[model samples]
Target: MKSWLWLLVGLWPAFASGNDEAAELLKRVRAQHSADVVVSRYEIEIVRTEWQRTVIMAVTEDQRGGRYQGMVIAPRRLADTLYLKRDGRLWMVIPRLRRKVGISPAMLSEPWMGSDLSNQDILQGDAVIDDYQHRVIARDGDLVTIESTPLPGRPALWRRLRQQVRRDAVPVRVDYFDQDDVLQRRIEFSEVGEVGERRLPMVWRIVPMPEKGEYTLLKVSGVEFDPTLPDDAFNALEQATAGTATSP
Candidate 1:
């Protein structure tokens, strides 16, 4: 623990220069991802060398309060399984077992719903940028590569991230690395087009490193962003359905 703190302190001075430019670029990227309320259906395909599985989910996340809720919509066995994150706590409620359990620190780092993606990856999208200090590392034509390090004491799963973003500040890909700077995973964004007012990635594919034929693909089946959610939307389950908005 002490060593990690020392490492973060030692690394702080190097990222000071160009932090302004990095900050501005991240702001635009955040704007592209930001929404007051996000209601969407996601089709997640988990692929492995031995087998493959797919899960469909309905998600309603209140970005303003940092609360997220999701329920499985497919695969009879795991159907109706629910997940919730509120007030910095993660909970997984299994209707099959009639159990609700808080996620432990170890479990928090594990695969989310048996997918290659981590729990933090699904529950805290804000932490990708908000918990990291970023700096421009490289540039090529319309593509800019930026390296980001986790802020000290932050609950960031990855120690560092290298994100390739477009000139318009839309993120194209992100590589996640551990504390030792070993590449762990890569997330690529494509099928880019306008979603509401933002140029969003309709398909996201995450690949694990070290020649493992394991990955997860999340495609937005239907989505509407920043809709006027009902007041009881996040408070009550029965009437908590997302507000009206059409996806084109």
Candidate 2:
């Protein structure tokens, strides 16, 4: 019994060290993707077996408060459509309806504009470190895999997440799992390049599980980090009124 107790005590520090390393690695990963503000354009392509649809949008994000505003600017029909997120709440402005509707937490997991990306995925921003409890699960070469569980009382759609990040702090792939621990989707990040003072992935491929040969590709363009954003950027009322006036 004495030897067993000693062995356990001797292994405790190694476990603690692994967790500490995981936290530090995650911190670095977050820093690489962090900015005061980010302005970018995204081309989202939804490829199906029978058809393909593409949408273009301008995105402005305030990293500090996790506020984001996106305006659809393509396809003529979706033009002037707006989405605003602030303080963990999302609102959508439809030009045809001339009203802004709030998005409930239950609907956050739904696809965004028929794309594989979810509404929650857009609003997550840089809050992963704060929303999940992480531990190092595996390490291979220069890549480290971390397993994360949603923190108690946090509003998260994925019950668990497994992310593989490079030693240079670039996220390569992330797998999302549901409450029943079933894998739902995976997002792969690539096209690493220098954006301002940091390196980031400029392309993201999202694939939903159990659906073969179907995926959504999101390509980032015109990325500007720490750009000045308008004060009313995330205001739902302002966006709704603008959509109403600019409806064409």
Candidate 3:
């Protein structure tokens, strides 16, 4: 019993260090990608067995990387459609119909705009630190690999995330796994360049599991870390959705 206790005590520091390292690394990565408020415009190319199309969008998000309001910029059919993510929930505003619809569970889990990225994926980047227990599992020189498990009661559906990032916090790749530990999809980051003061991925490629030729690509065209946006900036969209827009 004494020997076992000593063995357990000796292992705790290594375990604790792994956790601490993971937390710090993730925080650094978040700091680089997140800011007070970020406005970005991107193009998405989705190629699947049944369809292929491009979508252009503009998004404004808060510092947490969780809350966002996005508008579809092109493709006349879906044009002007607005989506809002706040408080871990989703809502869609239809300008032509003049109504707002709640989105959760079913809608959140499905592919977004027919792309491999789900609504959850697009909105929950920060949840890695905010709602997960992660630890450094391995390290190879400047490349460190970590595994994150969803914290209890968190809204994320992914069972685990295996992420490989550089020492400087720029992510190289992330593999998402399902409850059975089966690979669901993987996102690869490449074409790194300066986005303001941060070195960020200019192109993000996501391929679903069972490894087929199907893939989705997101190209970040512009990114601005602006903290100047007023808190009430999104109110117009909200009020417009409710058919209660007030003239200023």
How many pairs collide in each candidate, listed in order?
Answer: 0, 0, 0
**lDDT by residue (tens digit), candidate 3, 6-37:** 11111111222338887777766656665567
Candidate ordering by TM-score (highest first): 1, 3, 2
Error of 3 at 163 (Å): 0.5
TM-scores, each model vs. reference: 0.83, 0.81, 0.82
Clashing pairs in 1: none
Which regions of candidate 2 fall more than 4 Å away from where they truly are?
A: 1-18, 124-128, 152-156, 230-248
Evaluated at residue 242, the lDDT of candidate 3 is 53
lDDT of 1 by residue, 1-248 (tens): 10101111122222333587766776666666556677878888999988899999987877677667788898888988877666566677677665666676667678888887766655455434445787889989999887888777776667887878887866688787987889988878889878767776777888988748789898878777777777866652322223221111
The parts of candidate 3 lying over 4 Å away from their true place are 1-18, 64-67, 152-156, 230-232, 240-248
lDDT of 2 by residue, 138-161 (tens): 999999988877668976667888
